[model samples]
Target: MDGLDVLADETALLLASVESLDIEDLAHPSNLPDWTRGHVLAHIAGNAEGLGRRARSMSDAVPRSMYESLESRSGDIAWRSRRTVAQHAQALASTQADFAYDLAGIPADRAGDDMEIRLGLMVRIGDLPLLRLQEICVHHADLGVSTYDWSNWPPALVAWMLPRITASFAAREGFPVGWVEVEGARISVGPDPTTGVSGGATEVVAWLVGRAPGSGLAVTGVDAVPVPPAWL
Candidate 1:
């Protein structure tokens, strides 16, 4: 399926998972450090609202910041998370529906138009669908609520995101120069292959995003797989 279709499917799945949580479940710790499940729920809802606004702005040929500032973003999540689990579920569902509404009228041909997105980054309008999908899939796993893990990811997404994230890491100053072999795809990211990590695409993306312990990958020219420098 295309990225938009994938996002629609994932959003439905995530909402179902959110709906299953009880009030007490929101108080439990999530995989994200120092954040409870409440924080995750709040952030997801806020993200939908912000992204929907951006989509609307794009369609109008106007500019909009996803968040006013970093502090405002955190404050919004904290404030919105004070509600009960059912309230959070309602917020998620409503905001996601708003996002769908904002994007519905965007012509497929116009999706390729370059536009400034979050953090002043320029990307094709088509890329926003994949960005939303990435957020949903990654954060769903980050909720750490059940059997959700890298293995649950769509292999197509793993393939598509692995190179993009690794390239982001490579562009960072002081990031280790290396080659990554993901399910037989050799992705060389720097001047030379000074180090290497080989694994399934799911495992590699998980590692890149700080979701894995690197136990599943084969390493070469290092004692163990080096922790990836943060890219997001």
Candidate 2:
């Protein structure tokens, strides 16, 4: 199966996760530094809408140049996050519905057709599915969905994200300090990143994302930062 299949599966999983959130849980802080469960759902749903829109535009051969500006993307993110949590949930459902209905309108085989996309670069339409997966997988983990074991994760995603996550940890708040322990390797993100793997990857990733090594990370070492409840 291709990334589209992965996206579809991930979407369904995301939808289920959103559905399962009780208001109490939604109000609870997620593993992220400053987001609640509600915020996580909203962010995930918003990303789905954004990505689905990008994919549909590509299928229709429409030129999208708005994302060329990082400022523009930031503005959009801010706008989406501003919506009420309920509205954000509805937006997620609506966006998913639209994608499901519209997928049938475009020939599935045509998704692989390459054309000038984002910033006029040529990429196979099929690659968008992977992009969608990137969104889902990262956000899913951002919400602390540990039911899906690391071993069950898509290796493609792990390989692609290891460096990015490391970079994020290194540049976070522009500190670029501290040591990161993941899996069996340790990457010293502060002084050096060659620390390689150490203990549990999930623990390290949670810590890097502003949580503790266990459960929902509530503290950071050396400098304790009270993660705001809005980091979902």
Candidate 3:
């Protein structure tokens, strides 16, 4: 997939969702625990800025950190979440554009180069676009906008992300030992397969990533579907 092209499209969709909200709506609670719509927006903007720095760091003789520190990153999110609706919109638009510009400037030959992100984790320069894409798409849903919920995620994005997301969830400390059955493809999330959660790919992925409540899914070997660990 042309990651940049996909990222641009998703970003535009997220921007429109944000633009649709009134100033008073910013204070409303999001799908995420204890975070208002404003908090999600602030995090999205901060994420774009951080990822943009990572993209630019790939070419610098001296690479820079994605964020100064985890505490500072959290602090910035808290601080910026208080901005007026217009300020939040401007921050979101500008940071996304800067991120795209920085990501596009990296040479194809340097796509595999690694840069440090939050908590000293390293990611490939070429992966920044998709990383930012995930952030925008997921947080856009986090805004608790019914029109832009997980069900509205682009099919291409879900297809590209499902396997990776399942793998990541399986690796989490307390994930259940079971299989995730989607469209006849049974993916083993843990050591055992006695339990199974079957559903459409998008719904399964959404539940696995804590983006949605697992409803209308068929479950076996357990009274109810087990909640997976947090993805992030």
> What lDDT does model 3 reach?
0.81
For model 3, the superposed segments whose C-alpha errors exceed 4 Å read 113-116, 120-122
Model 3 agreement with the true structure over 132-151: per-residue lDDT tens digits: 77788888989998679888
Judge candidate 2 at residue 122 and give its lDDT: 49
Candidate 2 local accuracy as lDDT? Answer: 0.56
The CA lDDT at 70 in model 1 is 92
Candidates, ranked, lDDT: 3, 1, 2
RMSD of each: 1.7, 6.9, 1.9
The number of clashing residue pairs in model 2 is 18
**Higher-TM-score candidate among 1 and 2?**
1
Report the lDDT of model 3 for residue 216. 73
| Residue 27, model 3: Cα distance from true site in angstroms | 0.9
Across 66-182, the per-residue lDDT of candidate 1 in tens digits comes to 888899999998888777877887897888889888877567788778876677566577777777777788888888878566678776677668877877777766645478887
lDDT of each: 0.79, 0.56, 0.81
Residue pairs with colliding backbones in model 3 are: none
User: Which of the two candidates, 2 or 3, achieves a greater TM-score against the reference?
Assistant: 3
